[model samples]
Target: MSSRKFSIVSGFFLQDDQVHATPATIGALPPRFGLVDDSPECWSKFKSRIAELNDNASSGTTYKVFFLGRHGQGWHNVAEAKYGTRAWDDYYSKLYGDSEMTWGPDPLLTALGVQQAETARTAWLKEIPNGMPTPQRCFASPLHRALSTWQITFASDESFPQVMRKVMILENLREEHGVHTCDMRDSRSLIERNFPPPTYGFELGFTEEDAVWQADVRETKDHIKGRAQSVLDRIFDDTEETYISITAHGGIINGILAAVGRPSYSLPTGGVLPLVIRGDDV
Candidate 1:
């Protein structure tokens, strides 16, 4: 990493009545000991020593993350069930009437879902002071449903500023249960026939068939964890005092929690999970 020096105003260092001692009289020091009289070589050596001192001065810095979950009631369960039933064809015909149902994007949240998000915002704001500094960075999934949930939950909150919000179209956080690009145009029968078992039976010698299915889920989860890690790495590497808020799906949030070694943590709809990451702790 390249090293650079920048001046920063340190409020903690300001001289005030709170400080117990008087300022030291550097000008009263012996003339031979003055900082200006030091040679270039000596000054360079002194700077290096100060850098080392600073590094050893204290414990590592800590970063805090807050995760916001989207609302409940997705269409996937109903859609998948319809696909498995004989009523599938008739259901679609009746449901769409003259129009055709589109499968490309996920369905929007229900009215109850919107209420859930609003409830969460109201609950959260009740605890945190409105004047408290908001998170320095906010990230949200690109999907309309997730993005909508984020907007409705935080946009109305007095604590969250619109300028801090940013959307990240992370493919890694996309649902892993659906058909991929390769099977997009395939017939329903063909896709259904290729669907793998829900659970892996390890006693089966890790067969190629089993491997493929396991790889699909594992790779998706791994990618989600990697993306979460990348977000954290960027924030910490910059050494900025940024509190982070990430709005994503349940699966992706689960993956992040698992990556952080909290696999038991489950975030409910519109729930916020706060995490503190410390350099020394990590």
Candidate 2:
């Protein structure tokens, strides 16, 4: 890998868990505040990706709308900005000494990051005032920056129908981990305390401690590919939610897009892009 690539591979936070669950195999999608149980028609609509059963069908009716978002800028982004890619690859450890102790763990969003989140909300208000693209089910990276972005994006929005408000924290959605100290998330207890119910809540059956995180390993992009495919597979298979949002990192967002055969998207901080997933995509 080039030095720049090395910087990303070694310094960027990534979550590399290989989720085996697919939509077909995942037993059930956890309940979301806004999702309805799947119907046979919904499955039928899901299977026919190339042909729209109804040409004029709204996004909420036929397409599995995904609003994939990147979290706002964090302190880590600032750190990366301080050095050239080559410098970072060579001197990241020596200059910083230790990642966690030197820079700290799970850095929160910077002021600009907060602004980015606000911008997303404002744009949504202007464009989709009725919450047409608002997510019924939301998933976010477990890291602090991502969680903070998820909070800020919806901070003032009363537009989300009651069901779209709940947020699920997914370890799989985390950025590449073990490479960056800023990627380290707080313990499950801290998450439950910080992002509580009403605004953000955990999936009922998901665990607080994750074995995948405990593994303490960094994953290659190819591995991320598998992870992305699994995430997409499970999301489409498990839920009947018409609209969904994922608050994640840039790399992971690319993974998701790549998994589904879409061109990679460049999402800015707090950026939200809607993607329609069909059953056949998996």
- The TM-scores of all predictions, comma-separated, are 0.51, 0.70
lDDT of 1 by residue, 29-136 (tens): 112122232343543453354345455535554434343454443343244354654554334312322122233334555565577667656654643342223456
Error of 1 at 129 (Å): 3.1
Candidate 2 per-residue lDDT over residues 1-282, each given as its tens digit: 001000011110011112321222221121121122244343233324323532554443334667777888887676666665566545552243335423436777888989988776665565443223456788888888888887776755776465666687777788765555565667788887888766766655666664453233566787776777667666665776666889899888888766665555555666665455544420
- On a 0 to 1 TM-score scale, where does candidate 1 land against the true structure? 0.51
The lDDT, on a scale of 0 to 1, for candidate 2 is 0.60
TM-score, candidate 2, is 0.70
lDDT of each: 0.42, 0.60
Clashing residue pairs found in predicted model 1: none
Ten residues in sequence with the least summed lDDT for candidate 2 = 1-10
Candidate 2 steric clashes: 11
